[model samples]
Target chain A: MEVTASIEKERKTNLWGGGTSPLKASYGKIMMWFFLLSDAFTFSGLLITYGFLRYSYPAFSGPVSAFKPSVDYWPIPEKIFDAVPFLHGVHLPLLFVGIMTFILILSSVTMVLAVEAGQRMDRKDVTKWMLWTIVGGLAFLGCQAWEWSHFITGTEEGMALSNGVIIHGANLQVNEYGPPLFASLFFFITGFHGTHVASGVLLNVIIFYNVVVGTYDKRGHYEMVEKVGLYWHFVDLVWVFVFTFFYLI
Target chain B: MEQVVAVEVKPVDKKKVKKLWKIALILGVVTLIEFVMAFTLPRGYLLYAGFIGLTIVKAFYIVSEFMHLKHEAKALIWSIMLPTIFVIWLIVALLAEGGSILNALY
Candidate 1:
């Protein structure tokens, strides 16, 4: 037993005890993992808070024939987000946001492709993919701006409670939707996520510049591209969760 | 004597491109499925559960393929994933507490 134990100890030491890359991963990348983990906690807090608030309220029932927002219940997601751009009065729920999701995901694909090209030391391919990714990110940002503005300028007429509390469109205090907390959470969560996308765009721009200037080529590897690819993929991942929690649900 | 570098001009990997297109198609199809389900399914826990399940499936594909986490060292993947248990914990705790609060207040 002693001999077997020593051999096992030796093997484990050789694998992990030496001054080497932890799990064969770099410091910065591992740090990125930790950062993503913490960010995940932050998002969890926000989403759980949303769940708590949503649980506190009753959701609307019946078909469109009898639907109306009141203090009695929560507004159904489809009912609230049914407007389409340039087609006023069109009742297409969640369609535009779905398009936004696909765009972000397309950008993620480009990012990974850029990293893959960087792995192959294909400078031109990296540049092309990175540029496409930047465009995707920028397009997503634009769509978000439009969505936010539409949400702010809500189309549905708000119900005025008999207590003389008049709720119009969504402000920080109240909305045409069920409760004030609903719009507040929507703005906070989506705005926080939009900030992430915006920063991601800025990072992509910087990396795109570096790729064009042949910086990674001189360094003999595209670890930076790989790093950014991880972040871009993470942004897509978060959106997947958000889409489900907010839109699809 | 100077060293002469032999630069190999190679084509892009067709297989890699094919793989990327495959992933993109799969994600799109899944989203379409969710869309169909959203409108058709009666509002209840069943619809909610299905949507969350589909979302998780798409998430798995994105993280494993696009992030290349599956190809990374096993230890690395664990380090990143294990912390997610805390998120689950957060969900359970907050949901239960919120429900209790609602019960107590009303």
Candidate 2:
């Protein structure tokens, strides 16, 4: 009877603090969720404040003189973000960001698959999927880097700031990509998202190694994937807002 | 019977697995639609509405499907979602206050 009682106690303890359930989620998973929630609030604050700023500003009248395109007010998003790589001078609005969004979303899907595989005790499959997730993440990060550099570097014609600083006029009263606020929000929002993606990639890499070495198998569960999935999906979720607020609105 | 139970392992829930994938596909499609709309639509509140609508839809799908809150007990779902609602409310209030500030500055 004593032996049976001891076994039951061990099982109960294992059930808690060892996997994703009953408020006993593994420390990493719980922390990831908490981090995401806090991050969500921060992004929300930025976006809402953006809405207010845009609202209070003078209605965007056509090109702010000299740099004439058409439309008016904030630079049409299509015109500003339209440049695609390699095919320079060709205007393709939102294509790169659209592609980046797809990559991130796909990575989120792959993360879920890894978690699912872990639950099923398929270590090989989990490893494979996790590796793909990592690749997807890195690709997304690369795309973001390209986007940021493009934003920071001025066009060949040269962009002059109101203060006479010849830099990327992508911000500072703007030639394209909307208002200074638009570029400002774009950097802040996407910068934060990029940071999350980078961290997520690192986290996945660690878990991938753990899987390959049989840590999960030894421990008897794959809740790490689920926790990471929560984070990845949160990142994807945030992008939807960024895309809307920055790109559409 | 006792011997048989000792030898048998708990089965992975296949039905639950199928449901998860189905929901994920739905989310992907919604996101794809949002991307298309973003490209084609004119800039304005209409576009903003579409983007926000799609985002909320995507969020619903993730929380329901990926997070498994849909399958969890009502109390658990509430605990997770209620706080999220409060956050949303706070954002709305802040946005309103910020608008007033902007007006004052203008």
Candidate 3:
């Protein structure tokens, strides 16, 4: 009877995270998780809608065929993003986007290392990893900046009309690169992700500053790294979907 | 049921970290496979299925090992994953609506 009673007490006590939380995270981290969950739903909704639209439309032709300008058909992603930097007129399909994807994935790795160092409270290691994370974030933003500019400038030098609709050279409505909807969805999705990466960069910079000055050390914990780590990983998670939907599918 | 066995895992050591690296390497290989399938294959359910499957594997590793959610309490882990179901639901609903709209327009 005493053993049963003791077991029941232990169970009750252990019900609400009684066993762990070495970092002593606060309510902010939980709220961030909740926020990320909602944001993820929004992105998934957008991408799946893209999927449905692509499928419901008429299918693509062969590699040599130019995409006819219309809302009734979707563009092929690889053929659209084939332009490589400095190798202008070179048709290396999906190479630039592949590089961008790798950069983001590597940033995610650095963020994980930063989180590990935070757990161990190694100030030097934390600083090093956090700086690498920041650099990766900056590099991604730079790539996005270049991509956006290339998208805006386009390949042609004048307005083009397709089916009686006026579209700027390589604008969202139509493009020298691919179909109209391709440019439209490209800007919307990648723009949103770029905003997230930009914010994440700023956040990491702030945290790096704090770490340099021993802010978390003075507070007796380094949960801030854990919080930002969650955010960084969430951004990476979104990119996984974007990379699949935008570049691959 | 005679509940006589409770497995207590020893605290994580260098060996466990090495094991995690192996798992991560496998996940990376799976991601490369996804890339190949996406690029080489035609647009169809096969490509979509492969992409989503590989994506789930990648997420599993990031959450379990990188985020350290696996070592957390069951309640915490479930709480984290529970929200993803709603995301999936949202995707399904939006996809259906988008499909119907495109169908009508086309």
TM-score of chain A of each: 0.91, 0.79, 0.84
DockQ of 2: 0.29
Model 3 over residues A60-170: C-alpha lDDT tens digits? 654534544444456667656776679998878777777777777778777877777677677777899899999999998998888788777865433345556545446
Q: Tens digit of lDDT per residue, candidate 1, span A158-207?
A: 66876886666787976777677888999999999999999999999999
Model 2's alpha-carbon lDDT is 0.72
The 10 consecutive residues of candidate 3 chain A with the worst lDDT sum are: A63-72
Runs in model 3 with CA error above 4 Å?
A: A1-25, A61-72, A157-160, A163-168, A172-179, B1-28
Docking class of 1: medium
- Badly placed stretches (over 4 Å) of model 1 are A1-13, A63-65, A164-166, B1-10
User: Which regions in candidate 2 have their CA more than 4 angstroms from the true location?
Assistant: A1-32, A61-73, A158-179, B1-21, B39-41, B101-106
Please give me the total number of clashing residue pairs in predicted model 1.
0
For each candidate, C-alpha RMSD in Å? 3.7, 6.9, 8.1
lDDT of 2 by residue, A1-249 (tens): 999898777777775444336653456765666676677778777777776666655445544233333212445555577666797877677888888878877787778778878878888778888999999999999999998888867467554445675544465455344456767777777888899889989989999999897777767777877877787778777877777677765
Highest-scoring model, TM-score: 1
Give the TM-score (vs. native) of candidate 3.
0.82
Tell me the TM-score for chain B of model 3.
0.78
Better of 1 and 2 by DockQ: 1
Error of 2 at A171 (Å): 6.8
